[model samples]
Target: MDGPSGSGKSSASRGVARALGLRYLDTGAMYRAITWWMIEQGVDLGDAATIAARSHEPVLTSGTDPDGPTIHVDGVDVGEPIRGSEVTAAVSVVAAVPEVRARLVAMQREIIGSGDIVVEGRDIGTVVAPAATVKVYLTASAEARAQRRTAELTGTTVEAQQAAMATRDTLDSTRKTDPLSMAVGAVELDTTALNLEEVIAAVLGLIKERT
Candidate 1:
């Protein structure tokens, strides 16, 4: 699955994978994991040179269980830390580095090589796994997306989240490598007004048809 943050890629993909008995991988979390490690190491977020030089230093591991996906960096489970406001703020900057994306994209491809899995990321369908059998590009209204993101981003109002996500969308979509976009044959699913079950059913229906 491919989509901007807050577009229901992570949640809806997990639900679809669980329903289909397939593993799930959230590539966004992997980027966040690296960003968290960089912060912990005192790396300057604005220094692209330093960040790129050390992009491969920390080891990132992704757990593929659809029901409870996990991500760890250097042996520490960073599922919670990666979601913090600090990490969220810097992740886009770090993710914009070409070196960071290259490292994480390799890891994502390796994870998907072993078995059937549902992976969600900005460029999964376009760059990370171009040959994926069932490519889905999800979208939603900016207002709806921000409203959904507000639940987890404490201290941030829906308006703030919307603004932040809008900035992130621009940064991500214009990055030099593997920018966010729909693949040639991807199925575009608009979730502007769909509930969780409804979205999952729609993606599941796509997978069922392919199988």
Candidate 2:
């Protein structure tokens, strides 16, 4: 699965994995884990040279289970901390580092090789797993994406959430390495008028057709 932040890739991929008895991998969370680690180490977020030099320092381990996907950095489970506002704000910048992408992409590929899994990320279909069996790119209107995000996090208006998501979209799509894009022959599903269940069902249908 490949799409921007708030495009329903994470939730739909997890649901599809659960329905198909496959493991789930959230690549964004892995990026966020690295961001959280960097923040803890007091690394300058705006310093690309420094961030790239130390990108390989953190040991990121992802548990590929549909029931309870977990992410750990340096022996500590950081499922919650990685989702903090601070981490979210810095992840795009840290993730743009070529070294960071190389390190994490290797880790992600290693995990995917272990077994059947639905890996979700901005570039999974295009870069991480180009030969994936089923590639579904989910998209939605900006307003719908913002509303969904606002519902997930409190104290944020839909408009405000949408604006931040737009910024992340620009960064993720324009980044030099593995930019967010639909792989060739990827099935594009517009979920602007559909609910989560509808999106999951559509993905499952695509898998069935492909299989």
Candidate 3:
């Protein structure tokens, strides 16, 4: 699974994982885990070399539950901290580091080696799981994505939310290391016209047909 944030990639991927009895991996949360670690260590976000140096400093682990999985960094649960506004503001810079992607990609590869996995993130299908049995690229219109993010950000104006999403989209798409892109042969589902259940059913049907 792969798409811009707030595109229902997480929700739909989780549902698909459950319906298919596969492990779920939120690769974005893994990057968030590293971002949280960088903040905790007071590493300057602007300095990619410094962040890259400690890319291996902490052990990051994530619960595989399709719903409400937990993420930890070096034995400490940093889930809440990783999702904070501060980390959200700087995660793209950290995630753009080549070394960071290399480290995380290795870990992701290891995690998926032994079983079926539904991995959600910007680069999973394009970078981490190029050979996945079923690669899905979930998407939605900017208006829809902004509305969803506004709900999460709690009472934010739609304009502000839209602007932020635009910036994030630019960063994600233009980043040097494993930037977001649809993989070859991947199925693209525009969720702009589909409800959550409908989206889930469509993805599940795709998997069933393949199987």
- Predicted candidate 2, C-alpha RMSD: 0.9
lDDT of 3: 0.88
Higher-ranked by TM-score: 1 or 3: 1
Candidate 3, 94-181: lDDT as tens digits: 9999999999999989988865878899998889989888888999999998888788776578788788888889999999779899
TM-score of each: 0.97, 0.98, 0.96
| Residue pairs in collision within model 1 | none
**C-alpha lDDT of candidate 2 relative to the true structure:** 0.92
lDDT of 2 by residue, 13-88 (tens): 8999999999899999999999999999999999999999999899888998888999999999999989989999
For model 3, what is the error of residue 173's alpha carbon versus the real structure, in angstroms, after optimal superposition? 0.8
TM-score, predicted candidate 3 vs. hidden true structure: 0.96
CA shift of 91, model 1, Å = 0.8
Q: Give me the runs in candidate 1 sitting further than 4 Å from their true place.
A: none
In TM-score terms, candidate 1 sits at 0.97
* Collision count for each candidate, in order: 0, 0, 0
